[model samples]
Target: MIRMYGIKNCDTIKKARKWLEQHQLNYQFIDYRQDGLTAEQLAVFSQQLGWQNLLNTRGTTYRALPAESRNNLTESLALDLMLQQPAMIKRPLLQRNDTFILGFSAETYQQLLED
Candidate 1:
């Protein structure tokens, strides 16, 4: 089964969910807000896709951080921060099998959706 992780209020997540439904794809939505995320899960995703791809530096959550914290963008540090604030991470991370696509996009979903 596919696992989609993101906040429920994000517009991108909304679009991704809509696309999945329209395509009749079955995916378990994991909202980090309510359910929260484990450090082990973060480490696994970071290893699979790297922290750079998982972190959303341009997001409002990132921008709101202190300049000093923002300046430090190391993988370990970023992972630690993201583990605390999942919202700082990218939205609609679609995990299927051993691979995952962070961030939402219909094109990516189309390519990965079950056929």
Candidate 2:
């Protein structure tokens, strides 16, 4: 089963969902806010994608953090922050079996389909 993780209201998530539907690809959308995220899940994502890649530095959630919190962020701190606020994590994390594709791009999705 393919699972997509992100907030439902996010524009990127919306686009990704639309693309999936248009392509006739079936996927399960897991809204981080409504569905909730777990430490173990976050850990897995961190391990697979790297904490730096998973972290959304451009998002409001990360920007709203104190300068001290954002500066020189360590893996433990970043993981904790993401666990506390999932919006800090990157959007539309698509999972197919053991493979995880982060972010949304039509070309990437098409490649996913081919794979």
Give me the candidate number with maximum lDDT. Answer: 2
How much is the lDDT of residue 31 in candidate 1? Answer: 91
Clashing pairs in 2: none
**Candidate 2 structure quality by residue, lDDT tens digits, 65-100:** 999888879999999999899999999899998888
TM-score of each: 0.93, 0.97
What TM-score does model 1 achieve against the real structure? 0.93
Say which candidate scores most in TM-score: 2
Instruction: Give the range where candidate 2 is weakest over 10 consecutive residues by summed lDDT.
Output: 106-115
Put down candidate 1 lDDT per residue, 20-98, tens digits, no spaces.
8998878899999899999999999999888988998888888998999888779888999899888888988999998
Residue 75 displacement (Å), model 1: 1.6
Q: What is the TM-score (0 to 1) of candidate 2?
A: 0.97
